[model samples]
Target chain A: MNTATIIAQEIPDIEKIRRDFPILDTKVNGRPLIYFDNAASTQKPWQVIKAIEHYYTNLNSNVHRGVHYLSQKATDAFEASRRKVASFINAEHDYEVIFTGGTTESINLVAHSFGKQFVKACDTIIISSLEHHSNIVPWQILCEEKNAQLKVIPINEKGELLMDAFKAMLDETVKLVSVNYVSNSLGTINPVREIIELAHSKNIPVMLDAAQAVQHMPVDVQELDVDFLVFSGHKLYGPTGIGVLYGKEKWLNQMPPYQGGGEMIKTVTFEKTTYNELPFKFEAGTPHIEGVICIGAAIDYINEIGLEKIDRYEHELLEYATEKLSEIEGIKFIGTADNKASVVSFNLENIHPYDVGVILDQFGIAVRTGHHCTQPLMDIFAIPGTVRASFAFYNTTVEIDIFVAGVKKAASMLG
Target chain B: MTINEIQDELIEEFELFGDWMEKYENVIQMGKELPVIDVQYKKEENLIKGCQAKVWLHADYKDGKVLFMADSDAIITKGLVSMVIRVLSNHAPEEIVAADLYFVDRVGLREHLSMTRSNGLLSMIKQMKMYAMAIQSKVKAN
Candidate 1:
C-alpha cells in the first residue's frame, strides 16, 4: 500500500484530541488562542499533567540507593519510564535507554562520550545542512578537539537532503554519521532509515536526532538499526527537562559516562570509582524525577490515540494550511520537500519575520520567528529567518483559518 | 493618566497637523515642535546600537528632575521617541527610576510595536533609567 493511503486510513478525531490539552482553550490578547508553535514544544495533555502531580504527591523520593517504600516505588516508576521509552521507539532492551535533560544534552552526551571514545584524528563526522545547532555544535567541538574533519551533506533548494551528496561524503575515514529524523526549521522528514543503512554499509555508526520525528510517527530503532537516537519529552506532549538517549548496548557499554556524580556510580573510593550498569551509568546526579514520570503518561496518551491516526489528522491540517497560506499575495513557502512533517516556514515579500510574528500575536495566533537554531540553513537560503508555523494532531482547520486571516492581516499591515 | 486626557491632547495635536500624510510631509514643522539636542551632544556615545535607524539620546538633571532629548532617522521612530520623552521628560530622578514602562501597553501604543521594536524601546528605557540612577547616586554621594 502507498504511504498516503495508509496514513489516510487511520485518521483520528482531532477536535476530541484537542480537548485533552487545557492550554489550547485559553485566550491570548482577548482572542481565542491559535497556537502554531508545536515545533518548539507541544502542549501537554491532562494525562501528562496529572502524572507529574501524582508523582510529586504520592511517590516522591530519590531512586537507586534508599531502602524505604517511597524510594522503591520511585525507582520502579523511574525505571518503568525507561521501559516505556524503549517500547515507544521499539528498542530491543530498556538498558539501551538513558534519561537525559533533553535532546540537546543527549546529543552532547554522544559527542562527549561516544565521540571521545570512538573518534580519532583525521576521521570524518558527517552531518547534514538541516541540522539544529545542538546536533552541529557538538560534532564541531569534537572535530576541533580530536583534529577530525566535519563534513556536511548538502540540501536541495527544496530543503530536501541531497542523498547523493550524503553518500559521497561517506568513506573509510567517516567514523560517525548524525542527522535529524525531521528538520525542525524546514519540517522535512528525512529518509533516515535509508541514510542509516547506507552509513552502516560504510562501517560508520549513525545517530538520529528524533526530536521532531517522535511526535509525528512511529520510530523503530531496531528496524532502522541506528546506533543512537535522541528525542525530547516536551516536544511529544510531556514536560521539559526530560528526554531519552537510546544507544546500542555495545556502544553504551564501551563509551564513558557523560557526567560523574552520585547516582551514576556503583561505588566510589579515594582510590578508584566504578560505574553503574547500562542506563544508570550515563544518567548522573539528581535527574528530572517528575518530568520522567510524565513522559510515560505522554507515551500512554499517544499510544491510546495512536501515532498513525495522529499523523493522518496532522497531514490534513498541513495540507489545508499550505493551501490557505499560499493564497496570500507575495507569500513564499520554504521547505517544499516531498515527505514533510507538519511545519510550514515562509516569508512574505518585504515584511520582516519579526513584524509578521508580532502582528499574528495581536490576533492571538502564535508562530515562531528567527533562525530556529539552524542559522546554517538560513545562510544557505541567504535570508535571515522565516516565520514558521508548525502544527500538532490536535490543531484544527478552523484554527488554520484564523491563522490565515491573521497572516493576511499582517501582510496588509506590514507589507 | 486617564485615556480621555491623553486622547484629547493627541486629537488636538492631530487636528493641527491635518492628516497623517500631511503631518508626515511636514518634517521641519514636526521638528519645530520636537525639543532639539545640541549638535555638540550628537556623538557616538549617545547612539543606540541595534536600531536600523540612527538614534541619539541625551539627558540632563535639573532641580532634582530628569529631562531627556532624543531623535531618530526614521519618522515613525521619531514619533516613538517623542512619546517616550512626553512621559519621561520632566519627571523627578527617583520617580523616573521607579516608573515601569510596561504601563505603555495600557495606552495601546505598545500593541502596535513589533517585538524587536519593543525590545529596542525597552533597551532605550533601561539605558535612560540607568542614567537617572547614576545621577541619583552622584547626588546622594555629594
Candidate 2:
C-alpha cells in the first residue's frame, strides 16, 4: 500500500484505537458505546492516563520551592510540560506559556491582565456572535469595569463570520479583537490568519480562543502571530482542570499579574510587592501538576499519530457523516461554513434537541444537545439548540453508521 | 383507582412492548395525549429547575382532590411527567402526598433517563408532592 493509505488505515483503525480508550469498549444501555461528544471532552488514551498514574505514584512533590530530590523532579516535569506545550503551539519562548485552571480561567486571566494594562474608557472589544460564554462574558465584564463598549461581529446564517462587517467595525477605538479559531457550537473554522492580519494592520492585538481548534488541527501561535491563545487540556484528550494560555512576550511583559499569591511574586515587603516574570506571573497557587505532565504526554500521543494525518482523516469523516446524515428526512444542518471542523450540529423537523439527545443515548450514542453555551448564536439561528455529534480521529465510519441509525430511531420516536 | 393500582396498570401497559423502541414510541404517544395546561401557569416560578428540559407543572385542589397539569419542552420529559400526573392526580391531597411512585422502576423507566433527567424526574415528583402538602394545609385551615 502507498504511504497515504498506510497512514489513513492506521489513523482510524477502529478496533485498534478503541483499545486505547477503555471507555469505548464499555457498554451503554446494553449496546457498545459510541462516543461522539469529543467537543465536550475527549476520552483519555492509556498513554496520557498512564503518565498521570506514573506522576502520582512515583513523583509526588511540590514544585518550585523545595530543595529536596522529589521537588526538583516534580518541578522539572512541570516545566517540561510547559516546554512541550510551548512547542506544541510553536510559541517563541517557553516562558510564554502560562498554566491556568482551564480555558475559562485562561480567558479570564487575559481579560484581567491585558484589560487592565491596555483597555481604557470608550475602548471597544470586538468578538464574534459564535463565542462560548467563556469568551463573551469575560470581555463583557472587562468592558463594564473599564467603561468600554463590547461590539460583536455577526455571522451569516451559515455561521461563518462576516469579514466585511468585522472590517467595518475595526477602528482605532477598538482595543482588542477576540474570536474563536473554531466555534464550539457550529464547528465553523474562522479565518484566523486573515483576522489576525486585519487587526495587526490596525495596530490592535488579537486573542484566539482555540479551545476547540487546537486538538482537531495544528495551531502555531508564531505562524498566526496571535497575541494570545487559550485552550483546555481535557478537550485535547488530556486530564481536566489544566489548560495553557500562550501570550506574546511583549504583551506578557506589559500586562499585570492576573492573581496575587504564593508563587507569583518576585519580592514582597511589608510596603511594596513586585510580581514574578512571564508564565509564573500569571500562574498562581499550586497548579494542576499531574494534569500538566499528562497533557505533555497527550501532545506526544498526537505527535506520534501526526496532526496532518489526523486532520485529513477527520475531514473525510466529517464529509462522510454529513453526506449520510443529509439523506434523513426533515434533518437540517445548523452550521454550513465552507471551512469546518469535525462537529455536526443539526435538528429533526420539529423535535426538540433534548428529545433527540435522550433517544440517541438509549442507542448507546452520545451527543451534546442545547445551545452549547452559545445562547446568542442559538438566538441568531432562531433555535432552542441543535443535537451535536462531534467526532475525533479515532472514531470510525462504522460508528458514524451506528449514529445515523440511532438518529433515525430518535426521529421516528420523536417526530 | 388507588395509586398502587394505577401504577400497576401503567406497568402492565408498558409490559406489552417487547423492546425499548416500541416502549419509547408508546411513551411518545402517551405524551401527545396529555392535556395542555393553562398558558399563564407556564411561567418561570412553576418551571422545574432540576430538569435539563424545561418542565412547567401547575397544581390546583378541587373537591378535596389535587389536580396537576404539566407541559415540557422535551417530549420524553413530557411523557415522564404525564405518567406521574396520571398516577397521582385526582387523588385526595393526603393520599397524593403520602403515595409512593413505584411505576418508574416497575415500568423500566429508571434505566433509560440520563443522570440529569432522572434528577429532574425525582424533582418533578417532589414538586407534585409539595403541591399536595400545600393543598392539604389549606383545606385544614378552612
Candidate 3:
C-alpha cells in the first residue's frame, strides 16, 4: 500500500481528533491541562488503548508457543505489528523488524551483536554530541569491551552538527557510525540521508536513533539506505516496553544472536546450538505481546490521519510555538536548526530550568525540564539543562497561547 | 512557637493567594530569604540524591538547638528546603527530630509537588533529622 495516497487525504479536524485522546480533555491544578511533553512520550490514542484492552480481555496468550487458539491469535497479532512497522518505516521486508524493549535496547542490540561480530580492536565508532545517553552509552560500552575507540562528531552552539566534522571522522578505521535522526534535547534534525550516503561510500554502516523522528515524520529506510533504524512504541503513541530495530538482511545474517532463549533458537543441544532466523535470532525472550499488537493500532491511527498531514501540522505548530515563545523576555533557544522537529528547549533569563518547570506546572502545563537524558549535550552548551516544550498533532494553537502566558507567569514568579 | 503553631501560621499565609502564581511567587521570595550554606559544607555528602534539582543541606547543633542551612541551584527546590529549615531551625534536637511536618500538606505543597519533588522534600527532612540525631547521640556520649 502506497502511503502517498494516505498523504493525499485531507487533514483531520484537529478538535475532533483531540477528542480521540481522552487525556487531552482532563484538567490539572484547577486549569485545563496543556501537555507539551510529546518528545518524552506521546499520549496513546483511544484506538491503541482499546487494542491493548481487547488483547488482554480476549486474546491473552503467550505468542509463538501455545497450540491453543489464543496463542495462534497472539502470534498472528505480534507478527502483524512487525509487518505494520515494516510498512510504517518503509523497510523492504518484515524480517528486517526486530522487537526489543525500546530505543535503548534497540541500540544496545546492534552495539553488542553488530559490534561483537564486526568491530575490532583499534576500530573507531562515530557518534554525535547530541545523542541521548542511551545512544551514546551503549556504543561507549561496546568500544570499551572491544578495545575500540569512540569518536564524537561535534555540534555548534546552536546544537546543529558540523557535517564537515562528520565527514572528517569517516575512514577505514571507522567501523560504524551511530547518530540520532532527531536530537531529543535540542530538536535538531540532522541531515541523516547525507550522513548515511557519505558513510556508505566509505564502506561504513550507519544506524539512526529515530526515537524522536518516526512519530513526527515519514521515515523510508530503503530510500535513505540506512543500515539500521530504531524507535520506541510508547513515543509513537503505543504502549510501553516495545521498540523496533530494523537491520538490512545482510547485516542480520552476519551478526550473532543478541540473547539465548526459547523462540530465538532453531535447535539446541548440550553441545553447540543453532540460533533462529533474521528477527527471532535477536528477539530472545517472551516479548511484550500487548505492546507489540497495540503499536500496530497506533500506526493505523496515524496512517488514517496521514503522516504527511501530521508532519505539516506539527511543523506549523512548532513555528507558531517558536514565534510565540520568542516574544518572551530572556528566552534563549537552545536549538535553531533550519530543519528541526517540534521540540523547543530554552532557558528563561538564567532562572534555573527546574524553577521554570515548577512554575509552569502550577498553570497545568507539562514541559520537560532538565538534561533530557542528554548529559553530554548539556556539557556542550555548558549549562545544567533547559526547559523543553514539545508538541504533537492533537495540540492546538490556543494551548500554545496558554503555554506562552504560563511561561511569562513562570518567569515572573521565579523572579 | 510550637511546630504545629508555626505550620498553622504558614498555612494561613498561603491561603491569601487566589491562584498558584502568587503562591509560587511567595516560594521564590522565601527561597531568596533562605540562608546559603558555607562553601565547605557543599560536599557530595551534603547533596541529596534522587532529586531533579541539586540540593545541599547542612545542619549545626548550637545551644541545645539544631539549625539548618541549605542551598539549591533551583529556586523551587531552594524554597522547599527553606520551608523545612523555617519550621525546624532553632529547635531542640529532640523536638527537631520528632516534629511532624504537617505544614507540607496544610500549605498544599504535599499535593502540588510531583513525586520526585516530594521525595526530595522527604529526603531533606530525613537529612536534617539525621544531623540532629547524630548530635543528640554525640551529646550523650560526651
The TM-score each candidate achieves on chain A is 0.97, 0.97, 0.97
Model 2 bad stretches (over 4 Å): A1-14, B40-45, B49-52, B111-115, B118-123
Candidate 2, residues A63-140, lDDT tens digits: the string is 999999999999999999999999999999999999989999999999998999999999999999999999999999
Residue A93's lDDT within candidate 3 is 94
**Candidate 1 TM-score for chain A:** 0.97
Taking all chains together, the TM-score of candidate 2 against the true structure is 0.95
Q: Tens-digit lDDT track for model 1 on A39-111? A: 9999999999889889999999998789999999999999898889999999999999999999999999999
lDDT of 1 by residue, B79-127 (tens): 5566667767777778778775543554345643454553255567777
Off by over 4 Å in 3: A1-12, B39-45, B111-114
Q: Candidate 3's residue-wise lDDT over B17-128, tens digit each?
A: 9876677778888989887688999999888864467788877777888878889888877888888888888898888778898888878788534565532667778888
Q: What is the C-alpha RMSD of each candidate to the true structure, in Å?
A: 6.2, 2.4, 3.5
Worst 10 residues of 2 chain A by lDDT: A1-10
User: Against the hidden reference, what TM-scores do the models get?
Assistant: 0.82, 0.95, 0.95
Model 1 regions more than 4 Å off? A1-12, B1-106, B109-119, B124-142
lDDT of each: 0.83, 0.90, 0.88
- What is the interface RMSD, in angstroms, for predicted model 1? 7.1
Model 1 residue pairs with clashes: none
Sorted on TM-score, best first, the list reads: 2, 3, 1
Q: lDDT tens digits, residues A42-69, model 3?
A: 9989999899999999889999979999
Q: Could you tell which candidate, 2 or 3, scores higher by lDDT?
A: 2
